[model samples]
Target chain A: MKNNIVEKIWQQHVVHRQAGFPDVLRIDFALLHEVTSAQAFAMIERKNLSVQNPEHFLATIDHSIPTRKNRHEIYDKTAKNQIELLRKNCQNHGIPLCDLDSSHQGIVHVVGPELGITQPGMTLVCGDSHTATHGAFGSLAFGIGTSTLAHVFAAGAILMKQPKVMRVHFNGQLPANTYAKDMIMYLIAQIGIGGATGHVIEYTGEAVTALSMEQRMTLCNMSIECGAIAGLVAPDETTFAYIKDRPYAPKGQQWETAKSYWQSLSSDAGCRYDQTIELDITDLQPQVSWGTNPEQSIAINQVIPFSNKTKESLDYVKLKSAQSIAGLTIDWAFVGSCTNGRIEDLRVVADILAGHKIAKQVTMYIVPGSEQVMHQAQKEGLDTIFTEAGAEFRMPGCSMCLGMNDDKVPPGSRCISSTNRNFIGRQGTGSITHLASPATVAFSALAGFITSSYAEQQPQKEAS
Target chain B: MNTAIKQIKGLCAPMMIDDIDTDIIIPAQYLTQTSKDGYGQYAFSRLKQADADFVLNQQKYQTAKILIAGDNFGCGSSREHAVWAIQELGFQAIIAPSFADIFSNNARKNGLVLIDQPLEICELLAAAAQQNDLIISIDLVNAVFKTDQQTFPFVINPFFQHCITEGQDELDYLCSHLSEIKAHHQNAKGQTIFLAGAGVAQ
Candidate 1:
């Protein structure tokens, strides 16, 4: 039987399989964060199960950690307790931890690739859903709940029923000013939130191939947003080049052997998928969410229409159909998350704000995904650009993504954010969030409303 | 880890809204609570707040141990709290037209039975849930739910069905194959960075 890249990786990792039962798959790496790991650790303790392969796992304090100016104190009692529990749990289990002060500290997904802990042809599991971001390296990565995390902790494996393979081919060049974030948002809007519910989506074609590894990670990061178990791009020269010289990646002769192995991991010729979808993006536009969900997106140039679900979302968001979001004004513009907080996202925001100033009416927050990202931005003067432009350059953490920490969108205030997921009150109690690419968020920050980068990027001659 | 879910018989409430995401099942605000104990009161709290007479809050359906929901139920986020909330609210099983993959997996691992029925049957059940005299009885061994006037069968993954009936957690079963797991690692080539070739472990 011919297998796609997903099946190939699945077959390589499946330790045992039986008819009508889920395959027992080995986990190459298991990641944990402060928010979800405590319960799993408690469960492991209750069962008296020691961490089976402690070396194979890594823990980080990301969610529920404050990004505020206070260097150390976590004001929220719940956040402080969760972080403390994670530290205690990691110490008890002898697992490596990237605490808040560590150089490796960052969002779990960001730190994984940065430390070279993520690699091709491996099965990665994390308690957080954005673990799919690792699939950019041609790995099978998906989120597991606390119970499943404990299962992996005890056995270093997980039981999984194989998902059907679906290939989404983006077969054209994107117009200027569009980014990978737009590509994913557009795809999600085309296929409703439940479109890829049971399929492992493999994104292919010219548009997907043109995206850098960091951009590809952004694409995979939102796979869960649109209901995919995992999304991946086949490893190629870009993938190999990106992995080279990373901290945890194999070096020297090991690198050569790994490169050869990765080269052979693509889909076989004439591979058949359970389903294939071809999207032509020759005229794709920068996408922005107008309603309450990630799938409730429209082109920045398009009007918010009263679709079947729009009335309910609009009522919550306090928006009316036909009202242009461009000059609607916003209270917040956040630029970070597991989805778009990578250095590349930071550089885009910096590049946009180089000579410009953030609108006085809007309060923009620029957060790097990891400690490395922070240092890199400082070295590159991106932090200076943002700070001088009136945006607050904050510490590395999952800031305002789900509003677990000190940074939160005030109630009833509208925000244009680069983070994925615009679920009702996700950013805070009674807060309204609109999702967009980092470029769009940056541009909107300057406009003090939800505006598209395309208008900003129009040729000066044409604009004049 | 209490996986025993042999038979469940009780009144069920119908939430006919499509794409009922996990956030609505239990909001993100309630997730940070240290204990999983009080999630029951917050289950469908959004709907209860939105519509005062929501089915889950109704006096008759307050103790519903089964839920008949719309298509594509449990469709957002990988939060296991969705399952805990539903389970804490005394729902033993959820019968739906379909379920999101991760949510369904979480439900099974936590011993909450997920029954997949066709859209027509689900709609029928949803209507049946509105009938005050109707009681829903789920027979997992046979994979069917019985009402006074009708019998609708559902398809459950065989292994999940076995686990539900036998009260076996998947982790316990997987860990029992410790020898096999160790041998798998031992048989692999040195440097387990990536499982390189196509050969199965001896």
Candidate 2:
């Protein structure tokens, strides 16, 4: 059989061949972070085994380090210890680390592409689920467990089964108010969370091609939400241009060599997929998750699906059937995360909230994915708009996206979040979350309900 | 790399928390594509109001390998990072009443054992892990977990269990059949060639 992209990559990196249903593939890159690496490094010490491939391994500290200040001692002691442990582990093993103060230091997913460390046609492994984010560059990246982390440390390889491939083709132009975040959410809602189970989806179609590199990353970033192992876009000029000047990207003559190789990473024209899902971007609108799962979503102007009409698969979301979501009250509004916390997303939110103030009942928070993004937003005075609009501009970190760090919605509160996943207590214990794009989140914050910026902006258009 | 199988042993603290989604397990904000470096540092870093109060923050539990969690542990989005973070944080097996269906499957696929035990047993194991040296023995060959206080039998879908016991991976398993896979292709190629020749003759 002609090798697919996945098979070709697998063959290139094969260190050992064995017969069986479950195959252990050696890994090429092993990414680490402070939160999960501390224990793995300690385990290595306990085992007295040195990392087998320090060159292929990389580390960065992002999770616990407060994005608010770059000061070294500002983080809580435990956060400090975690960072310290990662530093010690990387130093001892001779593995390079991007400490918080480094320009390269940021959200692991964002830093990888920004530095050009996440290249196309490579297999990448990290302890973060958003590792799928790298698939935007056509790399086969996924997350692994700490034990697997140790195994990779000791052996520079992991055992993985080849998953079936699913092709999601986006055929038309996305509307103005629609973004990649909305596009993916619409697909998830249609296919259900487990629709892509055991499959790696390859996104195609004109709309996907038209997306900016950052937007493409956002599309791939949430593939995990729909139970996909990874999501990838075929490499093109857009991909090459984005990586051309990245710090770790090949330079000079090697740049040409790398570009040529990336160009060839696309699937053969007739390559067959196990499943195919086609979507029309023109028909899609800004989407938001009204229930717990990413799949339980609808357009902003729509009502919550009535439970009686929902498939059995959607019962877990606990959403009331037939409830109009347009005016649903909210307690919090969050705009950040690796998924939608980039500068572009912030720009969109700022545009929507420019002269408006957040409703009194709504407590809005904006977290940039990286310090770089934070600084860029501040430079553009977006931070002022957020604060003046009654939104708190907090330091960079995962924050309320997860109940981690200092930001969390109190239990029983309803929040409209720009982050992916509205799973039960995703924001906090007993907190209800609705996932929306940054623009929709901003609009909702101002209205104190789940509404659309398009509708709010309608009045301005009429006035003009 | 050593091919010899190494035995892993130590106290197991199964988290009592149930349905520990990926976000909570390793929040979404931390899911950046930076080198997988330093991720262990932020594992569960957000759970603590004061970082010191986090469950994994205590020095005594730092090295614990056995995690006892509640039902549907590792539920929500399927980011392998939850497994990576858990594994990177030194956990070998997660003993729970149950697991998020997908996470349990992925954990096994990635070589992290998910031990599903009775709720009572899981709670007891978690308590022991919190208080004293709660050493839990994981016999991959037997596919069983034994603690001084109790013996629990867990199921590893046969295919995955075989991979762990033999220290093999899924890719290795698939590659072993490369010759057979290649032969199948060769036969198909031969048939195509023969058909082309026959058509020309006709």
Candidate 3:
């Protein structure tokens, strides 16, 4: 119990502790976005409860706010109302609000770390599932609902049940063309989507250590896909270096003290986990989810399972067992989401689609995860490359990913997307989604089908 | 307060297929309504497509209060509508190999018990529901479930288990000790007024 960060944090803020249940874990940081926080703040007003700790809570407008313009009235009326509510709530509650025009404004998960608000050895909660993305800094972060969001707004505390721990160890070196997105997809496919259910997964071993802070974030971002409460990578020099110059990071001696504490937060040697999964990073390739769930994935080089071989899975996806995904036509190709919509994702997609044109039948869309990322992509001319390839370069938002905005696929349309979930009607009513990494999505867009870029180009080079 | 007897019990037919997302559970289109009523009728309506073969359309499964689902039962957005729809559809419990983290938490907080069993066990329950009129008795006090095929043990988070067993909402539970809270506030207020303590008053 002493080894748990949740316990440590709980002890610091213990007004009272009851037996037979996990301690009422007091939250230190409550990160919120416009989509969920607007309703939660409304509930708080109705209850007449003031925020207990205003400084600890932060808000940003992300989901519905369009990336193109800063003009508030240009958006849909509902989106305009949501943003207004968030602004009004923050003003009333005395909490910090990172509005669209602010330099720190971005995706809630991205903005938190870049501003150094997401620090090591902290317990962070957000109203979005991708809050696990903050765990890259060695913090315990997970999503909470609007009701719980209201609770945090009022009291800055939450009651939590301790989750069983699972340590995912990835050793050896990663192969070329393999990225953090591929690494997570491989883990989900290997373990199955439910493999880490009811468990908090700790990503460790050499491969995790070798990753940069941004890469580590991408790994933790998709922990929800595997049914894990959250995923963490123990903080190290890389994490410290990333936060050293960030705006909110502690300064001077306080920073040193924070580092010393972070160093001691790692799991002790010989510490036992409820489950341990090992993977060789060298064997991984870019992975794609061929079926509805993230676990129904295969390596870029592999073929979709034959219907007889995947009778159960085929029934769910409505595909024949022998139908190879290679050359299978697609209607739409989308590249963006909290999952793989970062600056690096844009750079990679641009690199792949640089001189190529998208197939006539396939309609492609490239949405940046945030305004900052969109600006960065524009500075690098990635937007031009995407547009030249016959892909629509859309404004930043959670566009086409969850169909929360106007961007959505029509029913029965099959789309290769870089977003997280591929559940039925996730994009729109009856839209079929196949989740993939950015590179796979780009290549599939060019080929007008689910084909691998590496495989298609490899044979041509060898023959030449 | 007296213990309320659970009015509904049975083996629930699998309403939707695998990876049933929050949108399908309750679409965002219906989120405009302020009240949590009338959602049950629209729950899984998109998937039913006016077809009687849809499980929710069946007469026997209409009143079922439990749901048995495949692996990764609720994988998608963190919309609480999914939990609301399940509860509005009258399901008190959902048994699955796994659930989306946020969905499970929302389900528990809203008094819906989400049970995570192994895949094989879920498949067994799903089969039982399909084969015949399967009856499942969920004893909240004992934390045990008896199905036609077998009796299985399901574990709920102790804190949530307490809340559900006591039939107390979280807000009510926290507000129950208002007198003690009020007395403490009064004493602090008096100290501040009298300047009897060094602690600063807001």
Candidate 4:
């Protein structure tokens, strides 16, 4: 039978398939994070299981770790205990962990791809939902809960039904000033929050091909946001080139074998998908969330949408359907998350803030995704550009994304953020988040409102 | 022999909001605890505090055992704490038109039965529960819910229904096939990095 990329990979790793149950799909790699791994460790312990294949897993700390100047002290007792628990659990289970003390520590998603642990065609699982970010490498990756994580801990497998496939073919030149973040946001808004529920998405066409690997990761990172189990872009030259020399990647002889094997992993010609949605983005605008959810978004030029659901969102966000969001004043600007906290995202924001001072009274937070991102941003002087522009550049973790740590938006303050979700109280209780591309967040922070692009930004008005 | 589900009987409350994501169900601030049991207090803490009349906070529905919601319920984040919170707060099941895939998987593992009803049926259920705390009974084996007004059927994956009803453990089942799993590493070539073409030792 002819098969799409997902089908090809699913068939290969299905170790067990009962009549009516979902396939017992084998997991090639797994990641454990501080917030979700502790309970999973407890579950493993309860089951009297030892780590079956410890070499196949790597653990890291991200969520609930402070990114503040005083991060080393771990002021929150709960955060400190969770981190310590993950450390002890990894040690007890014989799993390799990038503890707070390890240079490898970062957001679990960021750490995986950067160190080359992510590769094409692997079925990867992580306890955190952003594990879909690794699908940028053509892997069949998705997030799982602690039970599934422990299942993999003991069996190196998970029970998952093959999701129906939807091909989101983006067939047009990417409009200037628009990034992969814009493309994904537009797709989610068009499809609603539940648009692709119970589906697996494979991004294709001209627009997808043009995005860099980092950008491809950005496109796939929010797969969970649109309700897809995972998202994929077929591995091509860009994908291969990106993985060629990273630390954990296969070396010389194996690289030859891996490359040839990966080359054959794309969807076979004439294979059928359960559904296909075509999008033309020649004129797509930079997107920003006007309401409280990622799907409550519009093109920078569009008005806050009108609907009963959107009305509820608008009320929560304290906005009207009155005008464009381009000039609505915001209290904070955050430029980081698993969604847009990569090097390319930093470079874009750095360029926007190079000589510009952020607007007065507008707090700006620029957080890298990992320690590697921290050093790379400094090496490229992105940190200097950020600090001089008056944005706070903090140590790397999932800083301000979910804001479980020391960083949080004060209650009732509105923020332009480059994170994925804008769910109620996601950034903090009573705080509001507007999701946008890093470029949009950068320009908006500089202008003190939700600006579409730097070119359309207002001249900074110093507060009297 | 089956570890059959005891009939789950309870009062159902309505939270008809679409996309009631896990973050809202249990906020990230509540997730730092390594213990799973205490999250019930934090469940919907943000919503209940903001709105004085939220359903779960209502005098009538305080002990509600079944919660009904709109489409894509339990969406966002793979945090099992969301499931734990609802279960701890004494919710036995979530009835929805649809659910996010990750949340559904998490729900199954914890015996937090997820019943799939059409949006119209869900709306009906939610609307009825709003007027009065509707007592409902779930029969997982039969795949239907019994309300005082009527009996409505629901769709659930058989595996989940079986596992939740029987309280069966999938880990032990998967562990029974350890040899098969090791062989999969050998056969799933070029698809893994650590194993590469060099398979894992049996």
Candidate 5:
């Protein structure tokens, strides 16, 4: 029987299935991070269950660790304990640890693909919503709760209801300065935050295919923002090229076999999907969020519309409706997260700020997603240009993304961020967040306000 | 995790807001604690602050075991903390117009019953917030909720329904099928393993 790639993957991983019940699906890999794993590890100990597949388990410290200039030691007791718990748990269970100083350490999602640990046709679960980033490789990856994490630790599988498949075809060319971030931000606006509920989206068409692997990751990483279980792009030559010669990827002749299998992992022609959406990105402009939720976004030059939630969102964000989002003053500009902290995102910002200095009033931060990305940016001297332009080049972690650590957007401040999720008080209590692409964030930092890279040029002055 | 929830009859603590994300249920700051206990105090902390008269904070709704929420309840974040918080705060079940995918899954794993009803019904139930003598009864076995006026039918994934009624954890059920799972794993391994070939692109 012919089926789409999602159905084929489901069939490959089903260990047990009964009518009206979720299929017991086998997991190929389990990724763990600091904040969400401690309780799961403790549960495992209480139940006396060893990690069944130690080799398949990978642990890292990201969420709780301070991204400041410290060699070691977390000041916050809660964060310190969580990190310590993760290290202890990984050591006790013989699981591989991507410790703080490990070159491979970074956000779990970022490090996974860069190290070739994330591959096509595999089922991966992390205790994070952004785990959908792995779906960019044509794999079935999504976040699981701590209870499911403990279950996976004990049995290497999870029971899941098969999600209905939705295919979103992004037709036509994406205009300049509009990136994967814009494409997805625009998509979420088209469909409200709950539009894709109970479905897995397979992004297709010319615009999707044109995005680089890193860009594709950015696209899929925000699938959770739209309430989708996962977002996937079928593996192609570009996917294979990105996987080649990575640290954990199969090597030599095994590579050929693997590539052949990956090539076969696309949707068969004439296969049916539960829903199909046609989106034209040719006329798409750079998107920017005006309100609290991601769906409240509009094109950069547009004004905030009075939607059902607009009044409440405006009261929370302290922005007036019908006012142009452009030229709205911002206190800070952040360029990082599992969303847009890749090396490519850094390079774009660096290229923009190479000669121009940031506005004196705006405090800008360029946080790389992973240690490898940080190192790569430094090797390319992108760090020098950023620092010379007066932007802070911080270490890798989920800093300021949720402000779990010391890095936080001050209360009553407005920040233009490249991170996903602009929910009310997401960055900090009483902090308003405006979500945008890296290009827009960089330009906003340069202008000290919410502006676009494609806006008309004005006389610029160097920072005092 | 094994507590059976075949039925829950109590006053409904109505959170009428739509898209009550996990972040609002329990903020990120409180998630750092390794222990799942003590989360009840933080349940809906932000929302409670926003609206001081939030039903969860009202003394009248303190012991409520059922929650009536608006559309897309438990939206945002894959954290089980939201479910843990709700469970700790004394909610045995949540009735909503809809729920986010991950949050709904987390609720099932934790054996917290989540019933999805039509939006109109949810709104009707939510309208009875903080009012005395508005007891609601949920019958998990029949997948129906009963009020003084009417009974509304809802849907639950049969597997979760079985677990809830049997007082069984999902892991326990999965463990019962261990041998079958192991055999399937062996078969999958045998089929997918490929030998490293001669010198290929390095």
Candidate 6:
């Protein structure tokens, strides 16, 4: 059979199959976080089953962990208990956990890639939907619910029916100032948020292949935003180079055998897909979401496109039809999350903030995705540039992305964020979030408005 | 097809909006609850606050056991709290044109049915929900939904069908056969299942 990457991995991992039942698929690895895993652990305990394969499970505290330097002093009693519960559960099962004190501790998706846990040709599952981030390495990865998590803990497999394949081909040389973030935002805005419902999106084409591993991770991270639980990118040399020599990567001879196996995991020529989508982003510019859902977004240069469908979003975002979104005064800017919190995203922000000061009224928060990213940013002096420009460079975690922690956009404030999802009250109750790229959020923080660096007359630091 | 699932009869409510995300279903603040129980009280908190007469809050659906929504129901975040909330709120199944995969899986695992019907069918079921006591019965064995006036056919994955009909936790299904899965893993050669440059069983 000329199978695509998803089919190949699905077939290889089928532990058992029946005539009418879903395939009992083997999960090669599972990632867990604090929020969704507590109940899952309780389920396993009720069933009297320890983790069947301890080596295959990795746990980390991200969603509920406060992104402050003194993260150990968690203030929320419930959040504190959940964090402690994860620590206790990991110890009980002997599963490896990247505790808050560990350098490897960070966002599960970010740490999974950084420590080389995510690899090609495996079926990886996490309790968090952004688990799609690992699919950038050619793995068949998706988010699971707490019940599914318990299933994995007990048997290392779960019943999974195959998802129909949707090939999203991004054909074009991406224009300057546009990024993988913009590419994905454009696709979501073009196709409504539910466009890819029930299908695994396979992002392919020249533009997609050209993205760095980090960038591909960023693009794939938002697959869930458009209702796809998983997304995949066929592995290439870029993927192998990124995975090589990392802490948990295979050693010496095992590396050679692993690479060869990965090489054969790509989609076959003329492989069939249930649906196909094409986007030419050559003319695409930096994009921004002015409304609640990711679909309520448009090019930075364009005004909010108001309509019957958008009336609800417009009322919530306090935006009007045909009004320019630029220079609309933002109270805060956040540049973090599994989506765009890598070293490269920080460098973009630092470059723009080198000699400029953030607007006196604007509050900018910069968070690294992981401790490794935190160290790398400090090594590059990006931390200095950020604080010097009046931005808060906090410790690594999913800080203001979902407002689970203490870092929240005050009620009724407007902020431009680099994180995914602008759901109503996501940042904080009554807080309005304008979703944009890190560069756009950084530049907007400097101007205290919804502006982009691509706009002329913006302050620019000359190349050294 | 007449198996464990005979028929599911319940009063239905209409929540006809797209992208009813987990965040909206149960906000992130409620996520801190380590256990899965109390989220029922806080389901759709934001929308209920926005308007006093949100559909779920209306007196007619006070005992509603079904939800009919637009496309992409439960679209964002993988928090099972959303499913737990709906289940706790006395919903047996949600009828929508489509559903996000994670939410669908979570619902099925928790024994909450998600019936995929086209928009016109959902709209008909929704409009019919205005009058009091709009009871609908789902025949999972035959894969069809029957209402006061219309009988509409639906499609369901056989796995989800079995979960609802059998009404048993999937944990039993997974744990009973654990020995076999572990035995199979030992000889799982040539596959790079070990993560992070970790042991590749070389």
Give per-residue CA lDDT, model 2, range B1-202, as digits (tens): 1132234577766467644567667665565422343556667764643246556767778788878787657756545567777888888877787665457656775577877688988877777777887898888677777777666677766667666777765444443444444343344322211111111100
TM per prediction: 0.95, 0.74, 0.85, 0.96, 0.96, 0.96
Residue B22 of model 5 has an lDDT of 86
Report how far residue A291 has shifted in candidate 6, in Å: 1.0
lDDT of each: 0.83, 0.72, 0.73, 0.86, 0.85, 0.86
**Per-model DockQ against the true two-chain complex:** 0.35, 0.07, 0.21, 0.53, 0.45, 0.55
- For all predictions, the C-alpha RMSD in Å is 4.2, 10.9, 6.2, 2.7, 3.2, 3.8
Better candidate by TM-score, 3 or 5: 5
Q: Tens-digit lDDT track for model 2 on A1-464? A: 56556655665555444555345565656677776566567656766767864766778766666645544664466666667778888889988887766665667787677667778777788876678888888888876656567767765666566678899999889998889999999998888766776788899999999998889999998887777878888889888898776566666766776777777768887877888999887878889887766778999778776665344224433345665667777889999887888889899999999898988989988988776788889999999998888888876666677665557788778899988878766776667888988888988899887777634532111111
The whole-model C-alpha lDDT of candidate 1 against the native structure comes to 0.83
Interface RMSD of the candidates, in order: 6.4, 14.9, 9.0, 4.1, 4.8, 3.3
Ranking by DockQ: 6, 4, 5, 1, 3, 2
| Candidate 1 per-residue lDDT over residues B82-142, each given as its tens digit | 8988998888888888888888888988888888887787787778678764688889999
| Model 1 chain A weakest 10-residue run by lDDT | A455-464
TM-score, B chain, candidate 4? 0.89
A256 in model 4: Cα distance from truth in Å?
0.5
Better of 1 and 5 by TM-score: 5
Better of 4 and 6 by DockQ: 6
Predicted candidate 4 versus true structure: per-residue lDDT over A157-228, tens digit per residue: 888888899999997889889999999999999898788888889999988998999899999999888899
Report the candidate with higher TM-score, 3 versus 6. 6
lDDT score, residue A283, model 5? Answer: 85
Q: How many backbone clashes does candidate 1 have?
A: 0
Model 4 residue pairs with clashes? none
Model 5, A1-464: lDDT tens digits are 77898998888889888898788888888889988888888887887777876777788788867777783768898888888888888889988888888897888899888878788888889999889999999998998889899988888888888889999899998898889999999989998889899899999998889889999999999988888999999999999899888777787777887888888889999999999988999889889998888888999878888766567788888877777788788889999999999999999999888888998888998888988999999999999999999999998999888888878899889899999988877888888899999999999999887788633544223212
Off by over 4 Å in 2: A1-3, A70-77, A308-319, A454-464, B1-73, B77-102, B105-159, B163-202
User: How well does candidate 6 match the true structure in TM-score terms?
Assistant: 0.96
RMSD of candidate 2 to true structure, Å: 10.9
Ten residues in sequence with the least summed lDDT for candidate 4 chain A: A455-464
Better of 1 and 5 by DockQ: 5
